[model samples]
Target chain A: MRGPLSKRLFLWTLVWAVVLTLSAPTFVIIGASLTAGEMLQFPPEGLSFKWYRQLWQLDDFKHALTRTFYVSLICTLLSLPVGTLAAIAMVRYRFRFQGTLQVYLLLPFTIPLVVSGLSMMLFFGDIRVLGQLWPVGVGLCAINIPFMIWSVSASVNALDPELENAAANCGAPPVQAFLTVTVPAVMPGIITGALLMFILAFNEFLVSLFLTDSRTVTLPVQIYNSIRSVITPDLAAVSVVFILIAVVTIGLLDRLVGLEIFLRSK
Target chain B: MNRTLNRKPIAWTLLDAVEISASTVWPFRGRAAVARAFLLPAVLVVGLLLVGLGYIIEYSFHELDITTYRLKDEYSIINYHTVLERPVYLRVLGRTVLASLIVTFLTITLALPYAYVLVRTASAAMRKFLLFALFLPFFIGQVVRAYGWLIILGREGLINAAVTSLGLPTLDLIYTYPAVLFGLIQYMLPFAVLLLIPAIAAIGEDMELASEGLGAHWVATFRYVVLPLAKPGLVGASVVVFTLTMTDFAMPEILGGGTNDFIASAIYDSFFQISNPGLGAALSVILIAVGSLLVMGFFLAAGPGTLGFRSRV
Candidate 1:
């Protein structure tokens, strides 16, 4: 709509200001990571990689990094096929309690994360698996599988039903037809869902905090410990690493399917 | 395909065996069976979580024995009673709700115009830039972002360093109630914006133009046309931001500096510090109840499609 120039200018300015404020923390963290002198400070005394280099010698950080990868990989693997199947059923079939099932699939998400974490912790304790790392992966998978279903459902909804029918018409059985025809068509959705699940699992903190023991601590948990116990440039260096991964992932996501897929999946 | 499979006899045999076994085992002719098979694995995962919630409900009725670090065998309402009776618990609950409401209000207000411009701007470049900035922090999880705030707002951090150099006293910016709220608003802003974009886009530029053609001012158009059209998105974004902020664990823990505790922090302390699982379980049940109530109330008022779900049933 047409408006006064001054009014339009004001709206743009406010938008830009809010955008900058949203990004300020990342800029500050990166600047602090580059400090030449000791201590975390933005607008560093001089540019140096001392903190980044220091990270190599920290065994705790290294172990936490490996554990994080392990957990996230497990989370992705567990969620991927299950979520894909759920998506296919939800999108391609008529079934009883279909809408109720859809909401039930998102149950882990609707429950507060803290509540989920604590409940899982207690449940795992009862089952005698509280401190094991794989259960943490299981917990992460449960919380994140809904994203997988939603993402894959977007693609399943887009698939041409006639293609699968054609495969069947060619004397292919249902399972073979599905494997050959439907899977490739929905490959993009599967990949997107996997990427999102991996990233979310990698970045998960609260659930990890509740379920992990000292030996099984994940990267985010280690970062929390560092924040509470020590103020170091090393922490800034780790944060810079997280920021870089996020930047790279966003770039990849944009290139692969465009960023709007995120809106669709949500 | 035939030549390659002929050259790899083992692969061809395995594919045949798998297809024959599949047709024999499940007989995908039954469509309901196929659908049930497809749904069973995810339902199992959901089943595990439901059992966990069951455990929480069960544990909430028992009392923890601090000396033994084990809950009493006899189920009682003592844990819930303590949560309701304790002044500290009451205070934390009050603060969490108050802060969540404030953060939800501010995040939605800030997000609306940003979403509008991104959706309505004629310039593609401007829209691209806004999406990048919005999604940047979004991909960076809450814990890392909160840590970033620590480096910027800490005592010897950026703000304090600048303040001291300017011949002014340093400020204690981090680890306060307002600091927690500030961090939460920043964290929730992107989510609000993302949720708002689809709703705002649904309004389309034509509606705004039509209103203007009818001689409505920009403000009047925004109020009468945009606001009413975007109600689902606004409500959706508000509910999301509010519930997330209400149960947030990182911001208050990281920025509140051990003084301004939210309900999540209290739950953490009970379970880990005091070794009281029963109390923690009680708090979790309360939190779950409150969150479900809010969501159910909204679903009643705005419908389930607010979150962009298609109501297939």
Candidate 2:
């Protein structure tokens, strides 16, 4: 009782208290989503999955969910190669403008997503040659590539260059060496980057709001519309679904790639 | 080349093999060359988009044509003038900046002990639990998290229920400025922790041990040693949290309950609700200026820890 155990215990309690307080809303929402009552309430009135059933019956929810998945998938597919190449270059090369290039690649991180969406709409809304989601996809791809670069580049940077060199020295061609050796070394970061991109694109709303029409509404926008207008506890259920999906995906990711690497934006 | 091509008059496979072998034997197999070749397409695309942002800047200087719903032919600074003249824009901007700053401060204050404990604790199970807690909300995205707040902080929400059940007067908690700020703080707390963990982890145990040995209290040791060492991360998180909260549209819209419009909301209203693209562009330009200036100020004040770019390469 007299040692540092007390101090450590106090700190541990304080930390958990903060964590629990911050996370309470999410838990409450999940519980409220399952309530038998129509209105949202915590320690819910009764247990029921009525909202989930109702959410399943909505056409708008279905369309938005499908659109969100499809668009996020497309965004991930387009950005992975582009972002990976850029990440590899940023990591592998040293040139006169290396620093400048790094900064340039990362500038999108600072721009408000709302501003990005508005600007893209201003520039491309006039084209009328393409659909709304296509431009939204492009803008998302743009914002996401830099993040992709940052994430994938970390894995690339962590690699020991000699492993690739050894493959090359064994008479493997550059492409063969890269594919066989470098790819394995950097696969984790690439996968993590791709997953992050998918999640981000799937969840992105501000940019989607600016760019997507009612015809092209994504899930989050759909959710927002429901919240602003009329919707059932189905939304609360959807929110729970979002939380569950995020928790599971991130839990798997925490095991695979380690969420710690996100902080090492070196 | 001539010998390989001699039998390949119409043989594409032979030509492909010959081309591949040529590349295999080519000189100057350098990383820079490969990187340059690979970086070309992405750089071009992203750069062109940046140029598109430049076009928006140009549009901000023009008047909107209500007839055609486009920027007018003649350019003017009248959009900028209107922005400056309207106190609402400045007020919203100020509110955004203030709320962002408040959130940043609260996040750091709340995150510091958590990060310190996570880093210092020898127990793996505890660390994993803390990490799990941190990543769950981070993965949920801003919109869902804000909605979570909606259910909990609503007029007849849980807190109010708890209050009224206790014979205490219920307070107007949701849909106020503080409510939006409260949601922003929660939304940003994870990011702040993620940034701070790295910095705190970098601080060696010896420094703290040494400080304690030298007759310093824990707070004093933290003030002198830990805080100084953790500056890079704090500044980095502050910039990120600030910029994010300032440009955020989702939190304010969902949690603000239609009255507490931040800059991003203002921009959205200008473009869509008001249908003044020029005014929207102007607001955007100003927002960018505000964000960029804040970033630049922090970078100059704190040195190159803004993004904490590694000079390793």
Best by DockQ: 1
Give the Cα error of residue A64 in candidate 1, in Å: 1.2
DockQ of each: 0.57, 0.49
Pairs of residues clashing in candidate 2: none
lDDT score for residue A82 of model 2: 89
Task: Report the Cα RMSD per candidate.
Answer: 2.7, 4.8
Model 1: per-residue lDDT, tens digit, B1-313?
Answer: 6786558678456767788898788755657878889999999987778888998889889898767879999989999999999998989989999998899999988999998888877776777788899988988888899988888899988889889999999898998999999999999999899878867877767888899899988889889999998887898788889888999999999999999999999988988898887898899888878778877897788865446334222
lDDT of 2 by residue, A135-242 (tens): 677778887787687667778878888988898789776766766788788888888888888888888888788678889998888788888865357788888867
Give the share of true interchain contacts found in each model. 0.53, 0.46
Q: Provide the global lDDT of candidate 1 against the true structure.
A: 0.85
lDDT of 2 by residue, B1-313 (tens): 6786577555455545665886876655766777787788678657646866876788889898878887788989999999999999999999999998898888888888787877877777777888888878877778888877877777777888888888999878888998898888888888888777777877888988898899887767878998998887788788888888889888888889778999888888987788887888899889988899988888889865525334233
TM-score, chain A, per candidate? 0.92, 0.90
